[model samples]
Target: MPKPEHPTDPDVEISASATARELRFHARPEVTVHAEAEPGGECAWGSDRTNLPDQVEPNVTYRDIRIDFRVAAALTDPTQDPSSP
Candidate 1:
């Protein structure tokens, strides 16, 4: 296999994380890979927030994350609509 590039699909690897003296937390949830337009081009991107069930304590944040890991663009045909199913 060819050596992978510095930035590959799922290029910007991101995850839910946190730190604090009283950081009650959970194992980072599974990720949600997505496609988006960047300054140079389109790329796979992902990001997640700290998973907290409640404002059970001080200094906390509750949020959501989306997920998908398709073989995006595995078949790019010049004649087919990329968005068409």
Candidate 2:
């Protein structure tokens, strides 16, 4: 397996409405994982939710969300000389 390269920073915007809450991350992420846990138990990895309910009551406080972007190995290869052409 090839090592992944660093991805560019994504543009994140958070907004809330009367009916719902939304989080928009502008960029194509290679992998997106969302986890919601209670006060003690661990939250397993899950798929991204398009419709996440607004915070009604503070039941769970700890949450983990990760987004990963992978670049092609050919683009980040250091062995190839750029000026060789």
Candidate 3:
């Protein structure tokens, strides 16, 4: 196999970032990423932000989705125990 050109470990100022581009979500989502890099030294860094819809509708299909939840009768209640997961 051909060797990769760039370091997998992102720990330099001379780098680039790309995320959340051309994406559509029916509901708000938790975005999680882990990056290790230093800013400003001898190189340039470019950044792009999360992409949201250009337009939205209220009380329509474009509204944010919600999830309904309730405690099941058969579930063992853990509210009383702080150590419980």
Residues 1-85, model 1: lDDT tens digits: 1221323553344333343333433544554545544344434432222343422444454445222223222223457665689
Off by over 4 Å in 2: 1-48, 53-57, 60-74
Residue-level lDDT tens digits of model 3 in 25-79 = 4655554434332222122222322332334333334333222211111122334
lDDT for position 22 in model 1: 38
lDDT, residue 57, model 1: 41
Q: What is the lDDT of residue 36 in candidate 2?
A: 32
Candidate with top TM-score is 3
How do the residues 1-85 of candidate 2 rate in per-residue lDDT, one tens digit apiece?
A: 1122222221221222222233444433354434333323222221222333223223432233232222221122256564676
TM-score, one value per model: 0.21, 0.18, 0.22
Model 1 gets an lDDT of: 0.37
Q: Model 1 misses residue 4 by how many Å?
A: 20
| Model 3 ranges with Cα > 4 A deviation | 1-22, 37-46, 50-85
**Which is superior by lDDT, 2 or 3?**
3
Clashes of each: 1, 0, 0
Question: Which 10-residue span in candidate 2 carries the lowest summed lDDT?
Answer: 1-10
Candidate 2 deviation (Cα RMSD): 16.3
Query: How many pairs of residues collide in model 1?
Result: 1
| Error at 23, model 1, angstroms | 6.1
